[model samples]
Target: MNTTTIDKPATTANAPGGPVPVCHVIKGRVVTGTDVEYGPARARFATPALDLDGMVWPRREPGPAFDVPLAEIMDVLVQTGERLTRDPDGLLAEALEFSVLTSPLPRSVLERSYASLGRLFNRRSMEFQVQQELGGADVLDGWREVDGAPSGRRHRTRAFPPRLIHVIAGNAPGVAALSVVRGALTKGVHLLKLPSNDLFTATAILRVLAAVAPGHPVTRSFSAAYWRGGDEKVEGLLFRPQFFDKLVAWGGESTIRGARQYIGPGFELVAFDPKTSISLIGREAFESDAVLADVAERAAADATIMNQQACASSRVQFVEAGVQDVDRYCALLQARLGVERETASACGNPLASDLRDEIDGLRDMQPHYRVWGGYEGRGLVIRSEEPVDFHPDGRVVNVVPVASLDEAVHHANVATQTVGVFPASRKVALRNALAAAGAQRVVALGQAAMFETGISHDGFYPLQRFVRWVNDEG
Candidate 1:
């Protein structure tokens, strides 16, 4: 495999900061962030259990980046399920804590943070509502509609049924709210785990819940904290004979691999696996080069959405009727995207550099490549005769121009996540083909990133993934 990573300027991780305690809860199990020391204001989460011994968590920035010790967490998850009878709400309450803590980031701070992101894939609206509830699912209890008998039949049915642990992703600022909403509505208590990339948000959400439901069982039933995803030490405990009924996570390869090893005997895993995305263009793209330009730009924007970190961001394009037509379309597409700078939070030192190198390497592959912008600030563009083979460290794209949508989509790998299209009709022809070929989701040309909260992910409605079903036959 071609490994191209941009090298960042070296900086000390554990400068002078002493032990900084941040509370941690994994698989709905609580652990104070006591022993963890801060280190590396600049690093990536490649492993599990962060070693903050020499790290510094800066005040202005989201501090201390490190791996959650997968080995350690596996141990916990392995045993967590069987012990649920003892403290069923333990993990659920912790996640609630994280969701509440993260919801109210001072407008000034996150707006600035969002601005610093510089050309991200998705943008946040000024305001979003957070609905917190209980009994439906200790975690998802507050959804729009999720009760066994519905309406007035509440007295006969059991409320707040158990079974599920969620590991939340911080790719979007308000994701914790959504995840918690799902679990709560599904009636599952969450052992919500946060990504270090956006820990402040989770912490913010949790802080909110603690005040409102301080004494409730479900209130104490949840927990929110961070644990490197792959850590088996704690996570593994979930696999042994019903430690937890379910494990839900939003992750890529490394995190998935870690999940695989620890699924205990009676436990089930509802995974939203790591998938890639792409866009399809029909000869209909030729209808109006102007419209094509808009579509292309939007498609590219979809590719870079979430800095390309989101599984749904489009990565490749299938241009119909190749040649000068496709080339001209691509050129105009480039022109439109040339100066489009996004308002996204910049991932941090080494990450930016690493992503840049991946983009550069792809550019190098094609001698006909025409890079439009500089590597530093905003509006960065890299153009190739066809889309090149760029690695997605985030904020970079690998585009290819195919003669036909069929030729283009055939490249769909097991990782394909989203596919953008120009015409609405073509989706009918090729959608089944995509599913058979392993593609997961498809959206309109410009609407890829705006996936609604109501739709199902992959093949199933995720609320089902977050909550367990209990049947009592009369």
Candidate 2:
């Protein structure tokens, strides 16, 4: 393992007039400015929450001086990956454990989530991403002609790294880690705007980087801080075109909307909007009693991803089966949602009261629609003729019975992120139409969250978008 003597500079976590510790990184330095104490908000659904302890966010120039060549960055990442693989109990692992304490996820879920991220760090995986996502690794070399000369002029391009501001969503810890990886792979000077819910993971990861390779280009090129989502003071200073080339945001409507004022000619916004996913189960699932049970189990697996907090988690199911068969499937799914697994359990997050009331109102008004499970929020299943009006989150799913698989396509829109289909063979029949309707991915029923390296995210190759394709003619 390549180890460097870590030089952690002495700095105050608490500012002179601040209450809690304020944490922010300036250049390569991790400084905690406690000039303000933001929140002791709910990281989980219950008590024993976390407080926002950082404040000072400084703006600085970003350009070639801050950029690390891709080759060097890749080497460092490879070394870090080997170290983590050899000793799972290193500082990075300890930091991840601390992050989990502030998260709402159960212990098993956190373990699974962390392991998934760990697998993404190898040299082969990074090399594969460069090859698959952006033609080839040579694209990082300046001005490579991608196509034969047209009309006697050579057309060449470079994937130039941009100065990016990543507005990370706090729903999942993986987002923070992935943002760091993406920033390093692209060799961009990353300024991460931490979400209120997650303040530990990114900072912890930064510390780990500093430890592994002190003052390394990857360390110097990264920064992270927190401010209110729409704070005019912070956004006004940092969002200016002079400071950043791109604002990569991952959040709901308000977060995306808040970034619009800062975007114009010099700056661009690459957004991963809030999306909902569903499952399409064909009638073939009921061909045998055994098959029906197995298919229902797979549907349950998709429905409970991150306890239904993930965009890829199936919130609804459109089953092309009879009412009786669908009901049997729904019952089986409800039971499966509550089962314990090494990474997660079906006994998940609590359902919001408003959603519970809406479910109750529907049950009261429509006698035809049957409901299973209570508002205690472990897991609930509602059988309805059409998709439910509300967003099905918190392990609650709406099983909508359809006459044919074609009808399920209507519910899919530009906002739909993933579609898990049963009888994997049917995916071929429905794939093109779903893509046309704006769905990004289609997976086998139980594999909504099981992603391989190099798959496009939210309908685009994100790494391809992360860098600026600078073109030159010869």
Candidate 3:
């Protein structure tokens, strides 16, 4: 581990002459910093240099050294998961808490997100995802024969873990952790490009991995560093096929666009594009007085995942009901959105100044649209005629009333990611249309926020796609 100290000036962002030194774990070793950069939340923090030597751009070779057995890797991950579960108050968790606190999200929102992330860090979930993605761990070994081959010859394939660069999103802490899990499981050497909004969770996870299995092969194959997203000197060197083969990016339009310039030929990009989720509630939701509130609560649950910041979190809800029933459902949804929950809650994302102004403007134009709830960081719903023109930010939702679920299908397109359908059975009726419209996932009503291991993210098994599929033929 390498550590460097820098003298702090009298006038600093936080405390007087206090240095907030952050470590970027590079290939099992910690690299400290002497350079300071103005980071998120107006805080001055150490910026560690990118160690691109044998770590990021390694000499690509065929062997188990770069690719460990799946069982052994899983064992190490199980130990890491156990530590996170058993010792929540341990040093690693504390570091994560501190890092999360510095984010612009409200304390309540961060608390809820972190708590939800804790549940996802267990062994069962990790193992399930591994099975879902790769079918079994043996595929990593090389050329496992797929069923149904030619008479004499054989068709065999393997998911080869290539050198990868994971640009992680910070909206939900789960993304960062999941990236590490995928990278570790694939046995890929990773250069995790930590997002500016979050620079802590990955480092903390790395530390836990080191603690759980000191000098383990899987633990040593990872590295993390931060630089301005478009830093030419850094990206130019690392983006080449010689250095890295794949870039797994998770972010909004800007992040995806930035990675595009460096993508071509041998350099592949597995992009989990920025997307908006929606809820389609059939008229059945409002069919009876008995189930009205239940449907609304589920719809609220779908919209409020990660306080509506997650890509899979529903932003638009198409209620296939009469005007009165739609109004009633909207009212119920507004109430449910304000209730506190471990996964999502009322103290949601704080609306921006311009958004507040826009909401205020829409307030005057009634009937066309009605704004429910407050601009005080609670949650807001706009009952609009069609889909709202602007992409809603914060905890704002746009409830569009439709004549039927078919009409709702027209609104969904490639940009739409997840669709939570009411009454569960409705998904069957609408699945083909939703899939044709480019929606990746459609879940049971109110379960848009819910996740399962091995679920195809963006219509593909991510782990299966992350590796280099090599073939052997006679």
Which candidate comes out best when scored by lDDT? 3
For model 3, what is the C-alpha lDDT against the true structure?
0.77
How do these models rank on lDDT, best leading?
3, 2, 1
Location of the lowest summed lDDT over 10 successive residues in candidate 2: 45-54
lDDT score of residue 390 within candidate 3 = 81
- Tens digit of per-residue lDDT, candidate 3, span 1-474: 122222233244335444455678877777766354655445556565555564454465542235567778877877777776555547455655567545655567665555545455566776787778887777875568766666677778888877889999988778877887888878888889877777777787787788787778887888887777877766777787877889999898998999999999999999989898898989888767669899887877777777777888888999997776788888888878877765676676578998888878888887888889997667788998887778787778899999999999988899899999988998898999999999989899877767775789888888888988888764
- The alpha-carbon deviation from the true structure for residue 301 of candidate 2, after best TM-score superposition, in angstroms, is 1.1
TM-score of each: 0.66, 0.88, 0.91
Q: Point out where model 2 deviates above 4 Å.
A: 1-22, 40-69, 84-101, 365-367
- Candidate 3 wrongly placed segments (more than 4 Å): 1-19, 54-57, 60-67, 115-123, 146-151
**What lDDT tens digits, residue by residue, belong to model 2 across residues 125-187?**
778888889887667755677566657877889888778889998777678877877888887
Q: How well does candidate 3 match the true structure in TM-score terms?
A: 0.91
Please report, as a residue range, the 10-residue window in candidate 3 with the lowest summed lDDT: 1-10
lDDT of 2 at 96: 53
| Residue 30 CA displacement from its true place in model 1, Å | 10
Q: Who is ahead in lDDT, 1 or 2?
A: 2
> Which of the numbered candidates is closest to the native, going by highest TM-score?
3
Off by over 4 Å in 1: 1-21, 24-34, 38-160, 238-242, 335-374, 377-390
Clashes of 2: 9
